[model samples]
Target: MSARRRSISFALFGAALGFATIATGPAKGFDFNIFVDPEDNYIDASAFLARGGFIPVPVIITEPAVDGGFGIIGQFVRTPEHPGDQPPRTMIGIAKTGNGSTAGGILRSGNMRDGSVRYKYGFGAADMTMPIFPFGLDQSVDYHNKNLAGFANMRMRLGESDFWTGPRLIYRQTDVSLGEDADLGPVASRVRDQINNLFDSKQYIALGASLHYDTRNNPLSPTDGINGVLRLDFYDDAFGSDADFRVGQGALASFTPFGEDWSLGILSKYKWTNGDNPFFTLPSVDLRGVQSGRYSGDAAYSTEVELRRQFTPRWAGVVFGGYGESFVSHTKLYDAEGDIWAYGAGVRYKLARKIGLDVGLDLAKGPEESIFYIQFGHAWGRDMD
Candidate 1:
């Protein structure tokens, strides 16, 4: 069987075992009502989860670039210590895709110093087969990669304001090669050699700083206010990197409520890279419809907008559209050939009322194909980054 199929089977088995254990285990005053919404008479897990429940979250991969797959994540959460505080979380997950891509990781996120400081850290490893179309080539080549990576970030609030700044660090080691079954087709021998040389195994370490501002009414389901970030990163031999480069990125999102039932969201982002860098580290046009890395270059920018209508207390609907462009240089962005557009619609169900968290599905149509995504919380959020 394919690795992804095996992963799904194992996830199913684990889910069944988890349910069995919960069914037979002790329940001191625990009742099924904890999983029900008292006001709407609908099924909900907000209360149970808030009370430090352990849940198994299913991972479904529908990215056309990855050929789709499934897996699972096991999560444990601790309730916040005070009102309006974020709950601390710990998670471990593993997944595989039809294209022989596999990944596994463990992550933790929480607040410290009484919410003055926020911290996140994670470690992960992946083996993937990725398609790349270089220099506006119409055809793509498959690149196989094995990587191990880790990152940490800590941000402290700026006194009493809604601003935060911090330092971040990332380390990764990767080995890359042309896929064994890749079809070179009409690609030239010189181009093939160049691609091979650009993908040699290397270790990379980067140090960065970030500035953030957030004034959202609710992070899980923001109906008002703005959130934004600016970041700069340096990767150099002094930091144990095999390549020296610098990257700068910025993003901003705003939410405005039109009434009790309507809300509008807009998000914009831009990224640029300078100095010698690996091909895999280049920026790409990140939009719902575009496959990851499908439109990458030295610089890229994208803007997306979403309109949401709350149909009922428990359900909402949304329509979104976006445009993006990738270019070799800032001066050539206007004339870039890698420009594209996409649009889609989706529905959401309020899964956790207290936390204002919603679960949903989206169907987007990009330049090449239509793809569906299973989403939790805001699709564009970076809270756990």
Candidate 2:
């Protein structure tokens, strides 16, 4: 979808959600969730399985904690079938500063500590965010260890709202591990220059801005809504000059039809890469695709349409199918344009007013994959921005 189209779609989606929340008694409070995704056996070598969610509690400390509230969240998940194995446990400490910027504070798993500050000056016309953190916190499972790692993410926006069209600038540095065990190791091990490469060598710094419009229903408890996000990116490698700072763009559209006893939605994604690109920042959902960063060096797109109708207020049935293809640059990949598709049905169960749990079995290309998806904060593909 074009940026204009995506913006319009998002606006409509947000509006729907807002209307739902206002119409429905305005539910509130914490949410605990868990879900499993299993597509690891795909030949593309990109899929995997995992599950976890936040702890539901009254720890939220801000009004509409859904938006700018802060609290502690704990959860865990596993890959069981990945190249490396380790059941990771996570504990996140969150603190919100305000609503002017999309920034906050985070202390995760003890190894990663980050602080973010966001502010808007000049009558909220200009906005800025600074995120600073130290890595290598998760590498040590035994003793509390320290390592050489640090990076910063900075963005400046000149827009009245977070979703307004504007120019943005970002800078990041990822590879610089010290005193930490090599990835998949406990202590004294090789150092990974970048974090993503620590597990699989893929790292890069991306800088870009986009023009967008977003309108969606209830920021929370959205059963029916719509959203669209469009972005353009320029990526530069901190390690070497592999790609000429590849330029890429992503377009997405999603919507849930209103008032249907059954659910119907459409999600579309399109991404294009310029040159030899780093694998980490590919515009694809992890474990949701056949390959991780599978469409890095070329152009690719995918679209899925789903219809879900509820038999009971707590139970709903859903059916979905879609196709996607990626090429190593339109010309070189001639016969290499890989295609993927899946179709399936599932049951959704709602818990409390803010959470929905779904279990499904999808046939990917031919093989059956089981998936348990969860809904939190907002519906899938919907962003506050």
Error of 2 at 111 (Å): 27
Instruction: Write model 1 residue lDDT over 347-368, tens digit each, in one string.
Output: 8766677777777778889998
Using lDDT as the measure, which candidate wins? 1
Return the TM-score for each candidate structure.
0.87, 0.46
Model 2 per-residue lDDT tens digits across residues 1-385: 0111111011111121232332243233212111111222111111111334333222232221112233333332222232211122242322332432222222222111121112111100111111111121212121111111122222232354334443444333223222234454532242333542443322344556565444444323344555555666666555332344555454554556657585566767676666554332333321231322223334667677777777765445666676766554343322333456655554443322222222222222211233333232222433223
- Candidate 2 lDDT at 243 equals 42
Where does the lowest 10-residue lDDT sum fall in candidate 1? Answer: 1-10
Model 2 TM-score, 2 decimals: 0.46
Candidate with top TM-score is 1
Q: Quantify all predictions' global Cα lDDT against the true fold.
A: 0.75, 0.34
